[model samples]
Target: MNPHNPNRHNLGTVISFEFRRTVLKPKFWLISLSVPLLIGVVVGLIALSGQTTAQRVESQDTASVTFTYTDASGLIDPTVARTAGGTPVSDAAAARAAVVAGTSQCHIDYPKDPLSQPIDVQGKDLGLFDSSRYNAVATTVFTTSIEHKIGNPTLAKLAVNPPDVQLATFADGHATAGIAGVIAPGIFLVLFYMAVLMLGNQMLNVTLEEKENRVTEMILTTMNPTTLIVGKVLALVGIGIVQGLVVGIPASIVFGLLSGSMGLPEASAGVPTLGSIPIDAGAVAIGFCLFLFSFLMFTGLLVAIGAVMPSAKEAGNTFGVVVMSMFIPLYAGSLLVSDPHGVVSQIFTFFPLTAPVSTLLRNATGGLYWWEAAIALAILAVCGWVFLMVGVRLFRTGSISYGSRVKIGRALGWTTGR
Candidate 1:
């Protein structure tokens, strides 16, 4: 490997050119900045209206209502009803009629056999969710009356409303954040998918652009097809990183500020924290490898699709199918989590397109064994290299033909020249 190899120099030149050409475009900046700007605007509005909105909600929830109840079980204490914003009324029929006529907000009828029969609640409909307040008021009054009868307020209160629970699980004799600790490795998986989604179309266009512009011949004359294709794929990845940074940095800052303003606790008992999350060095290393090779395999696939099809429109149909294949594991996410070693999960873990996501998912869930990760990584690395080679062959054949689709047989040297 000579330091000044001509092909290496050409590859660098190609990468530099493609990256700058895409990055410097006004449309690139517009698309990249639009999401963060929209998020910022929304956050600003929420921050400004937070106090007013809280006050409005509190006022609505505590608003007085003309409520009446008929207690056939003799459990309705008049004092409790009045305190809970309800009135005890005789003649259930008259109370129901008042509610229907909008003179009263609600009417509750406690059955004679209270233990066996349901309480009948009739109310003026106040829209779907809000109408539930009627039942809430009636229940509160009945519960308070029961507490009074028990004559032990503290014990009754404890029985009625239990204290908040915080659960902690032990792993290998050490306390861990449970699900969050297990799924932490999946962050790499998420970043890989994000990069692919952002750059998949770019990968499709990179190989096809030269053909579309009818300059493939001139470009091919200066650089080998392998160098050019690899260079363009690398550039597409570079572009994805740039987009991720532009979006992730501002979003992170806004999230930090919003979390502080919202009074989120840094180490809540149930919530997972950075220090609490368990980290396995081997798993993290394998996860990063999975991310890298998976992305390369997908990029190669899209580039090959672009090289084979004559135009972007024609290529996009194939591109969509390929992208959808990657999500096959996600559709079976429940099975993956519940039974990662099952036949279906095993199929996805080994299959080329779905392997990256599947392996990563199982890795995060602590279901994928180290050996399985190795096998999946090996498959992805091989497929990625094969796809790149296939793309190079296709580019050589398809780029020479303008406005016509290149048959796979001819592209791969199975048939006569195109």
Candidate 2:
């Protein structure tokens, strides 16, 4: 706390050294670049496959098929049926018998009382989707016959296929992007987890590296543990920011180029240019706050675990458990979105570990109320601070306890030393 403290002066030095130590590694750049590159490769393959399939579909007439029809409704034009590869048959029984006997490809029976009886279509049992071909062929024949009767092709076409209806929703007497507005906060949620997942190991390594190298005692002689850990946390945050830019920028560029062709729903359709997505400023503010506190909470907890753990191998399983806990709320993601006030969602929103992700998800879906956001943010902020304090205490007690795990009771002053 002293202004003249050398440890305070050395804080900047520690941050610089830690930041340079991490970013200078070849592995860091490789892993950072690989995420976007890997995603690009997978998406490229899927797009190529889709294009190939579309080409194959266009190269062949998928609807062409042979069938027989008996139109007692006087609706079937003989010329149209023949043109569509459907032969007109007088005996409906013979038509069906021919199909059953394999003498015909399929049979369609247009009942005399078309108003009361259904049109019957029979074909060899093909798979579910493929077997609809008989109905498709018969439908084309009937529609084309109706078009001829109407005399005006355009009018008949309009009568058969009505104009599409576009539905728009308004909020506050103004047209809003509807679901697009609701999902806009999800960008913050995505960035939060992206940094957490990418930087979790780094949090553990930052503190553990000193212990592993037998340098913790020596380092503590020169710098306060609090300053050292705080510096490392700050440096890790900087690294996360850089990595986020690395991954997020390229992804944004690729998505902007591909969104139109990707058939994204209206909410996120087309390139997400400025002012295109209806983002609620309040929701985004809440989301950004939650993201920051959540990242800090996870960082503090992971760093605390590193302080207590003697080696990476000893901490691996614990690290996996903590990571899994962050995703637990996602399993009930649908419930969170559909019924944010539901019992399950409430539990996840308040629980120490699950609160960050669950609340972020609810905020993204427009389900998080302001009061709930306040409570969630307060909980995360307190937990982050508490976890950081716990990490410092654990480091003081366990940093030099090599080849053994530290007992929480002693590390946290819950029990006296022997």
Candidate 3:
């Protein structure tokens, strides 16, 4: 390899060298090995937690409902005990006692023809309390109770179910499904942001290692810096995706099986009839693409950072700030649930550094319009291109650049050929 001869950029050769860079590194292999095992342990722990939650919800259902009512209150029937849905109470004291003791689901105590008194409701002639209705049971007892006693018979029927809000939401979906959908955005955001950190640092560390060892001169003879940096970023991005798939696929499979086997209490609660984990193939695809794109965007930036810094030490100092920037998306990601379509969120969705994650979050939250998603993807693609170009420029110049501590301003100037 002649140092003076200019190396022609060949995509194939550069990629070959990049693969070698990853595979030959002992520390890279060690990290790769640990990722799967750590992921498996985390998945197992989550499954265990889910099992406990299911058991807790199921156990709570056995506790009977207790009611409080007065038999002589006239609203309650003292002569005949009514089922939980009817006006059945012997006395106010007994009703209150049953309520306190948790022996009854509900109680209806009546006055001795209490409705005859100065109506407690004041000016209301409607029977908010009726004593005669208890003799013959209605087919729908609670419905009749509300319509005849508590609500206007002519107007819209109103049944203010007080217990419903307090009761454990046994899941036939309810509002819980909507709430769960909202969580998808934040989960995708944090996951993509985390993957970026891993891939970004991996790219930075590799570039710095080569620089520190003066291997750039050796590679420069065989490959141009532009081709070299591009190939390496591409290769590392692939590895990051492979890593994501390895972790995500197994976890998804395990979660599905566990969620099915360990039937959650509210799992069958509401409308959509959820029997298993809600993960669909679409979720897997979105997660996969998000993982890949996020890693690419962050890793490209790291490669550019690596090119400008002459030594590993200089790069490490800047890495603290870089790392913070990558992870800041996670903190901001939570807002996707509350304000998925808010002004601030929309702006971040369009911005380059934040778009990959913010856009992914919007998709997960069902906030994304088709055009917005397309635009964000386009922006990310352009940014990747720009980063690759900048990385090469910085690399070609900074390969021979020597200094005490490199500065960002100096790197920017160098990237622009200053």
Clashes (N, CA, C under 3 Å) per candidate: 0, 0, 25
Best lDDT among the predictions, by candidate number: 2
In order, candidate lDDTs are 0.80, 0.81, 0.57
Count of backbone collisions within predicted model 2: 0
Off by over 4 Å in 2: 1-4, 40-63, 69-77, 89-139, 142-163, 182-184, 265-282
Off by more than 4 A, model 3: 1-10, 20-43, 46-191, 261-275, 279-287, 403-418
**lDDT, model 2, position 72:** 87
Clashing pairs in 1: none
lDDT of 1 by residue, 1-418 (tens): 7667889999999899989998999998887788678878887777768877676556555766667888888887889888767777788999999888988888889888877998899988878756766766767777888899888999879988998666666656755445544534766776677777767778898788888998988988888999999998888778876876687667546655564444333333544344434455566678778887898889888888888899999999998899799788899999998999999999999999999999998988878998998899899989998998899998987787777898889778788852
lDDT of 3 by residue, 261-338 (tens): 444433323424223544323443564566566666677777788877777677777777867765555688778647
Q: Name the runs in model 1 displaced over 4 angstroms.
A: 1-3, 36-61, 113-117, 125-130, 181-190, 249-288, 416-418
Which pairs clash (backbone N, Cα, C closer than 3 Å) in model 2?
none
Top candidate by TM-score: 1
- Cα deviation of 402, candidate 1, in Å: 1.6
